[model samples]
Target: MAPENQPTTGPSTFIGENYHIWVIKIKAYLKALNLWEVIELGEPVVQPLRVNATLNEIKKYDELVTRSPRALTCRHSSLTNVMFTRIMTCEIAKKAWDKLKEEFEGTSRVKSVRFLALKREFELLKMKDSDSVKEYSSKLMENVNQIRILGETFPDQKVVEKILISLPDKFE
Candidate 1:
């Protein structure tokens, strides 16, 4: 088979921060390249070719084997050297991804604490008289996005309601 082309741009290197955003970007990147399954679902399991195996069997096996390394390579290239050191021994992308998630994502308690803080911020956010609607909305959404990074599915309807209530009386 011919060599495949890769995208010109990819996710930001993981440098011990913004794990959520990096994961989101990288997942999308991998999905676009049809490489996310190996990372998400782990490597594919295939049987060895039998003696006098058909050409199709060889091709299928080759593709499965090749994807494992390709996915691993994508993960390797996306990490900072310091981060890469943590996963240096990971020959599979799934293990590397899990290791990063377990380490940086913190424990459930830690995530809960963070989620609550962001939730409060989201709840208390109000537009100032001096701030434009766009600016105010942007700030509000930034907080929401951070909450999502924490793994909550913050509702779009709720954000819309908040935006409506946050507007100054002059706009009403």
Candidate 2:
């Protein structure tokens, strides 16, 4: 659902088009509010399911984690542990960081933090390192929180925000 006056077609609807509108859409979608609700409240509505679905698909291995706890704890722990470790290595982290960099270019780019921070965060989470995990998780979670705040502050970039808001917890 796009807003009444906002254009939906052409380049205006791109994921990184306008951060303000994207953020607004994110807040509404995060609250589980639909287009009808937004319209009723005199707010613009926009659907960002395209980007959301693509991003959600990034968790291709998620199904492997939802199996029985015993299976995961006993058999899969080592495997998953190793997988996440590999994902966090400098090589893999660099690739992912590059992809994100390409996705959000110009003013939308969030490449302020160093690549090592992301690698360390993923490593701590994978290893279940209590102290390290707490630290990295806090930092990563802070970034996510900032995104949410952006969604709240911007009224037009609702679609982009909604797509970001639907991001799933990696380990949950």
In model 2, the worst 10-residue window by lDDT is: 70-79
Q: Put down candidate 1 lDDT per residue, 81-170, tens digits, no spaces.
A: 999999989998899888988898888899999999999998999999999999999999999998988889999999999999989998
Which candidate achieves the best lDDT against the true structure? 1
Task: Put down candidate 2 lDDT per residue, 33-87, tens digits, no spaces.
Answer: 2222222233223333345565455453343222222221221122234333432
Candidate 1 ranges with C-alpha deviation above 4 Å: 1-12
In candidate 1, how many Å is residue 148 off?
2.3
Best by TM-score: 1
Compared with the true structure, all predictions reach lDDT values of 0.88, 0.36
Candidate 2 residues lying further than 4 Å off, grouped into runs, are 1-131, 152-172
Task: Provide the lDDT at 126 for model 2.
Answer: 28
**TM of each candidate vs. truth:** 0.84, 0.17
The positional error of residue 159 in candidate 1, measured at the CA in angstroms, is 1.3
